[model samples]
Target: MRGLMSAGLLAMAFTLSGCGAQPESHEAHEAPEHGAAAEDYERGPHRGRMLRDGNFAIEVTIFEDGAEPEFRLYAYRDDKPIAPADVRIALELKRLGGEVDRFAFRPEGDVLRGNGIVREPHSFDVTVTASEGGRRHRWSYASYEGRTTIAAAAAAAGGVRSERAGPATIDERIDMSGRIEITPEGKAEVRAWYPGRVLAMRAQLGDRVAKGQALARVESSHSLQSYTIPAPIGGIIVEKNANVGAMTGDRPLFVVADPAMLHAEFFVYPRDAERIRVGQAVALRSLSGAARLQASVEAILPTADLASQTLLAHVHLPASAAEQFRPGMGVEGSFVVAVQPVPLAVRTRAIQRFRDFEVVYAKSGNSYEVRMLDIGRRTPEWTEILGGLKPGTEYVTDGAFLIRADIEKSGASHDH
Candidate 1:
């Protein structure tokens, strides 16, 4: 009878267990949903995301409103507001390819602020430390601030070229405004050999003639016979005063100029006149930048312009540049005055403007990092680097503007 009762009790226990098992399995699946909600990130009073360790927390933000990018921190303790003076905070950021930067914060009212500008790219693995009550707590997190990536094939198609930064000879140049005129060597004045009457005029104004070509027939006063007056050089007749019956004397009858060769004249300020010298290389270009010619400082006039107080410089243009230019056309000349050797330099095309800073794209393997540069002297081809870049570092020398466009397209708009 006892065995029969035990079997009946065991069956009753099994039935009760089966009834409870279904709800327990359902609750196990629902627990994960609750845990996910708890793991969601929280923000601080500054509206920046917060990171916490023990009873201390810090909210980091980049503040830029008509100012440089600065790291602003808000501190908390046990989920409550903490006095900035009670704790000391520090930050160490490690960028891609092993660049590291450290910052020490000082208390400012209810928050702590970095002493210097927070150099961009803003993308980095950040480690922050908060010390209070003789105890230190550190929090580490990865930030994807203004990050963009490009494929190698796309970069190649864009004409991108990479080069290592190194020393370069930077030529310091002086800019001067000038105009093209017919050089004295390319001009001629036609005059009669002796007093005579112009029997006939062969060449008129604006007519092209060759050397020793007859310009007019003259009846010589010494002899009744007529003689031909010849052109002194091959050029266009710019001026004519001789008529069919007019008498020619010592006065010039025509002005001829070889418009193919020109001279560029510029004025140097009194302060810069001392540096002016003969034989210095000069580059003359049209105002539109379409036509360019190389010349040299042919002469420096001793006399200065009475009104402008400037000395005159003459640059001789070659005849081959005739088609691209003409007499009386305006031009600008770049005079290379000094050649400076810079310890570190990069191609001028690599530089771009990002916010308030001048930046260059630094390359490492397949990645590019936006690097801010402090520059010194510069030439048309290269620029001297004062800071923010190291020697032997590879950088994008061409197609940097395309990369900048891609970075903008990626919406990598971090605060300045």
Candidate 2:
């Protein structure tokens, strides 16, 4: 497939190089060496191509002020204006992919107007024929814009790659901020069963302990018997407030939290509270974006924060994420509220601003041209194409800016 495309591109380049005026012929003939230089031809007062054949001349122009582009031609003889009805004209445009557009003209006011509108990207090889006074005149030229050709090798080296435009699933998400915390059921506070003196302290802050494991030895003040203080849960000791000879009262002596069981608490303001619900999927990343994972909302606390008046949405994390995530670490989350399937879409990164339109470059062999788009729903990853691009069309997906730069370097004109 690639070899065939390369051969086609080479053939297109060869054909484009032979662009010039040719006499009328019934049989296919080899195009003469390009000698017209018509692309740089003189412009008439209407800013249209001025083609002369001895004493007869005609100016070709595309007028598109308040309407679609349509052909408007002016005729002349002996360098003087001539009646439009006295001359007959026809135009044929051969586009890049061998598509041909034929236009017939009729007198409209002082100029001859074409029957059809000229579509965008305005790049083609044109053949024009005019008849008057028993004589025939023909002209041909190449008028191209917003297009560039790069060799496959150069394109690959420049990171240019293409993909077929097609349907995609877009995930609509709402962003929120949150912090990782230990769930209530995953934390335990250790306090002496009876008023006692701390006879011995075994566990230290940040120590990992097993459930019911001995953490300390305390002597009861009422019975003078020393009792073992065991850990209430299997987790890391986050807080320790006991020491040898320290008297224990109602205060907790140690706080153990199960880091393996963690949840992220995202704040939901009034504007978004109605949209949040348990079981919705969420993508979470650390504030620095160095760690990321997928989880689902496990619960929504009924009460809102006293200061911020924001509700809490909790998403439980897997034990595997504990290595990268820690309690109180700030995280950013994207909650998927909806998923939509679009008939045609492109990667959001592929879309670029060209003139006043958001566009993506469509690929034909090695030739790349602008495709003005009508965009609809968009996410960070994909954008729905409402119009202006055909399904299954190959388009620049990577290195689109490189193609744009090459076209801009040629200074392609929007002239009619």
Candidate 3:
């Protein structure tokens, strides 16, 4: 009779166990119900999908009401966000209800921080979705704070990343691109200055000739006979289009000038127009990023090209630049437009960009304090400062790239 009772108890226990088991398996099976999301991803590049898992998560943080949207979801691996090139990231994103948005990530240690915007102000939704190995996961927060909360979080961390809104620097120098061209400081136009045919021509590039030297004898239209026209100045024949038989039209056929009086013309975008002047001294350096050649500003065109919209600035080459600085050579120049009157300067590589602000890690009291400044004037070698910093500031100029790259990597912005 005990064995019969034990059998009945075992049957009851088995029945109870089955009832609990079905629900968990059912929940697990139903958790992946993202058919709508999978369809949304199918419309994206590579048919991208929103997902979430142990290795990945999405975070958002909003700051300004009128600012551009700045939030992103991330796909992390081993507690780190994956680069786009290393993973399948969709370039195009679609919002279903037009409120679930992706936000940029700011990584601090192993955890990622972000700001999500609520279009309704004081009330919004946060959605985190990512896909991995053909699977998707999603989660959302409707109680997340709006811009004020984001600003508060940024304030607790010092600031978001602007001058008025956050910690700022006095330095504003950013290394941009520039090109080289022929300078007109000491230029001479070898024109048809009179028209004639090519006769007994011996002028070639790099040929050193004296003043009043005959370049070519021509049968003048006025004389109807061959006459000699000597060079007005002692210089080299830098450019020659006329051969022994080339015809001369109204265009320049040969360019003769003193190589000693050379200048470098740099093509710049209109953004730099206000920072340059006609008489200010500037240092012309090589794009190889070395301070090789020195120069000074000699001229700045009052007007810029309306179409290409380039600023034409003239730099005078020193006597030491003779015969070495050729036309069409690429060089960069730093013009000191406005000065704090003998302020200190340092290499541009020593500076780091913190959000929308410029920063340089200064070695103060045996520690590296990243100081933000209002960047003043800048060249490839040194960045000038106006406030929030000092001159002769000791920092890492050669190896600061790693620091900047780290900040960008942590920010997880597509631009980085």
Candidate 4:
């Protein structure tokens, strides 16, 4: 009677317990009927989507937890786990770049296991097939938009930086060898007006003389009157043929060069002559790499060198480079062939190959997102951003590969 009384009390408590229990949520009740409710799509046991076929459902996930990523599947029938040996599975992935891969699974202990690892970044259209009891079921889905995160400290240590994208000036250049020469307007040759004897010499070789400064005094043989020969330009005397009492005929007494304004003569091949134009910026460098100058194309000689078939382009050097240059110095010039302005640009180091697409690491505070870019024109140091990036936004400029390596190591490669 005591045992009967206690059993009756337990039954009465159980009946009262039902009155206080919480009812099942609407989502849980609808998942089976609608084949994995929207909220539970990525909330399954494997953190993957569940594909339903008739009464059986398969949850697919790429298991990359601290190891190489691989496809793992869970099978269920009528809300009960199905035995692995009862089903055969195969997975096929078609990538965006027209690449296709297939994986087959076999029974391994309690679950169906893939024969090999799944390629990263797990972004593709997936087709999964399962055969059970001599009947086959198929399901399809797409995943992996290419995303990842990194610690702020790690990113800074890896040399990652970002900036708002902005416009940049791009100059297309044509490289060619050239030589320094004296500008025609900057050279002067002082000569006697008539046949005479040089009575006195005021200037010598290597002497700085100003325009209208007397270089030599000469006594004409006809008039017997002395006349002074003045330097036509302000420069150092590079040539002095006059001596005291030396007879002057048609020869010049002195040659003066004003090197502050000089010319870089570019010997362009006939094939490149048509593209050469005046007023374009040119960068000149000595063969020894010790000297550099900025100049502009001033003229293009019409005649081509008969032997070399090369045309001459004269570039005017700035006064700043005058002291470092000398006539006949061998140099190289990069002439601007074209100039373009890009509204958005970034350092070339920011770009990296992530799977089938060219990508950049976009940073947002402590996290980094993989941004696929549509690229356009490219220069040596910068690349034009046509898409995938916005102006005034910051991104990784250096050490981007560090982020990529970390993400890929985390099974985010997503490339099949």
Candidate 5:
């Protein structure tokens, strides 16, 4: 491109046949020898003294093949390069044009732009300097390009190319990852517990039924006469509170849907619940169908159920698997209790229960050694070991029960 531009300029100067001789005008001079503009201009072609000149405003733009834009100056009649470091910059953008951002030059190759660098390209001006003896020449250019602002700035500095910055990152580590659902779980509606006519159902079943959706109509039965029953949960009603004139029973009249926001609920031990989160990734498996599912905890119910003696965990299913799941299904899963990946872990089945101890039959030196181990956070395929293990230790995962059966048979043979 530089050669092409230089050649074009020389050709145009050759065409001007009748032009009069002037010191600064093209008269009796040969085309500046290759690299003469840069190598000779600084030397005044002889005394080797750098002389300062007027601040000529120049606009620059850059085009990059694989990275951010680079800068080049096309500002002065005698084109000089502009650079980023030469001018002070301030951008009114969240990312673009910041000290560490990327941007595209506005409207030309001498412009700049990039992803981490631009909101939108705007016109900008800058002041630059070139070494001339003991003084400097300075100037500025407006940018409208989108990705390489720095490139343009550099171009305006010296009309020379600058190197590309390091590769940009994809930034895949999400600070948080979780699932969301339109519904929740185990919702009991505060509907009438006893037989009663609708005194007046004030809160409709689907009216975002609160913990207590009440009916206003008075009743004839003593139970009904005693008190009005409010709906227990806040949910869209799946059933009506009616049969207006019929003898209503104690059974739930308003089949208030306890929306099952979670695909499955697990009981997390108190010690485990303390480490669990509302949005931690979990791997769930259906005990019946052997389907593997990935999901997030929708919630950790506020308090443990006294009778059940367990903490309620609501798991929101992956959108991909929701179609095949329903409420009240049995599932087994591991909730990531920690963020950091631990070492020396294997599938939970790699170990077997030996009376009251956790033991793994490890193969070493041509013998099986029953190894006692400490357990940690467990995923469906891996269980982190807090003790008694190391990476690359050969241990059996599946067929453990079969191994035990074989050992028992051998003992019977010995007895025989």
Candidate 6:
């Protein structure tokens, strides 16, 4: 089953090569003929790779005019045209990772056409053989494209790194805005036990105090005896209503709030309120983004605000967060509403536009080539792959643009 899947993927990869605009030239490396300049080669009218061995020769070209790329070979004897039916040809292309693709030719019109399309990244070692008139001929050459080798040090200096493609979990989140506030139970009101005159105020506004600590000394009007009023809770003095000589009655003397016991109240509109629930995880960030923490929703207010008509989602913070966060500070939150598991995925940043396809640079040893993908679900961090890549393939996860630039800079063609 694995082998069949691999074969299908290979065929798909080859087919995809024809879907995009062809490059000017696909040949990267070419083997030089013995005792001759590589550029000084005999050309046939078809403008293909012309091979000659004395009286017998064949012109090899890839025909891709409004169709998939396929091999079209023309045969000649003593520089004269020969019937294509009289010749039989075969070709084997060994690719970068030792995968070999073989093609057999059959006569069509005046040319002998190969059965399979030649895939992209045309870098390969090609072996060609032909039989005619009961005589055999063979030749070999190197043709390469879209591949480059950089030293390990050079790759590292260029910030290129590779990782194997694998499964990943994508977090689907909802963005929310809210403000930090002291929890209802975290606030306390300090008042004199009876109607009394404030004798002396010991604590001032904004002062930090402990529970039972003296906040004011009050003299009762009935008993005419002075008594000390202590803080109802260990917290900061947010509101101070009493002075050194003011008379206390029904109003609170001081309002103490525990900044350490804080919660973010996120307003959720009617459209999104259905998706929110207690215990859902949330990632909280301060308005400046310098402070961040993770917390879970503790409750959702049943009633909506009269003015905004938005429900409130309360997420309590840990005591340690008090150092960086304060009540009334605005905060941004990402609520994790769902998680999707995908079998094969890649970093979204690794994908780049190549011709007409979205691709990532797949690395083998020091050589890198493009891998076109069929993408599914996508998030900011990951994109799920539906096809066009094999599992366990090592691909560039960072600095993929550098590889694309290098390939383009070389003027490597996508032609056959």
Per-prediction TM-score, please? 0.73, 0.84, 0.40, 0.57, 0.29, 0.74
How high is the CA lDDT of each candidate model?
A: 0.74, 0.81, 0.46, 0.70, 0.42, 0.78
lDDT order of candidates, top first: 2, 6, 1, 4, 3, 5
Winner on TM-score between 4 and 5 is 4
Looking at candidate 6, the ten consecutive residues that score lowest on lDDT are 11-20
Runs of candidate 3 exceeding 4 Å displacement? 1-180, 185-199, 221-224, 243-253, 341-416
What is the lDDT for 101 in model 3? Answer: 39
| Candidate 1 lDDT score at position 305 | 86
Task: Output the better candidate (1/4) by lDDT.
Answer: 1
Clash count (model 3, backbone only)? 28
The alpha-carbon deviation from the true structure for residue 48 of candidate 3, after best TM-score superposition, in angstroms, is 50
**What is the model-wide C-alpha lDDT for candidate 3?**
0.46
TM-score for candidate 1: 0.73
Better of 3 and 5 by lDDT: 3
Model 4, CA-based lDDT: 0.70
Per-residue alpha-carbon lDDT of candidate 1 for residues 236-255, written as tens digits (9 for 90 to 100): 99999778899886668898
Among residues 3 or more apart in sequence or in different chains, the pairs in candidate 2 whose N, CA or C atoms overlap within 3 Å are none
**Predicted structure with the largest TM-score when compared to the true one:** 2
Candidate 2 wrongly placed segments (more than 4 Å):
1-39, 306-308
Tens digit of per-residue lDDT, candidate 3, span 312-363: 7777777777555665668776666654433555556667765556776553
- Give the better candidate number (1 or 5) by TM-score: 1
What's the lDDT for candidate 5?
0.42
lDDT tens digits, residues 52-109, model 5? 3454333322334375434433333254644433433222222112213333333234
Better candidate number, 1 or 6, judged by lDDT = 6
Clashing pairs in 1: none
Question: Cα deviation in Å at residue 216, candidate 2?
Answer: 1.8
lDDT of 6: 0.78
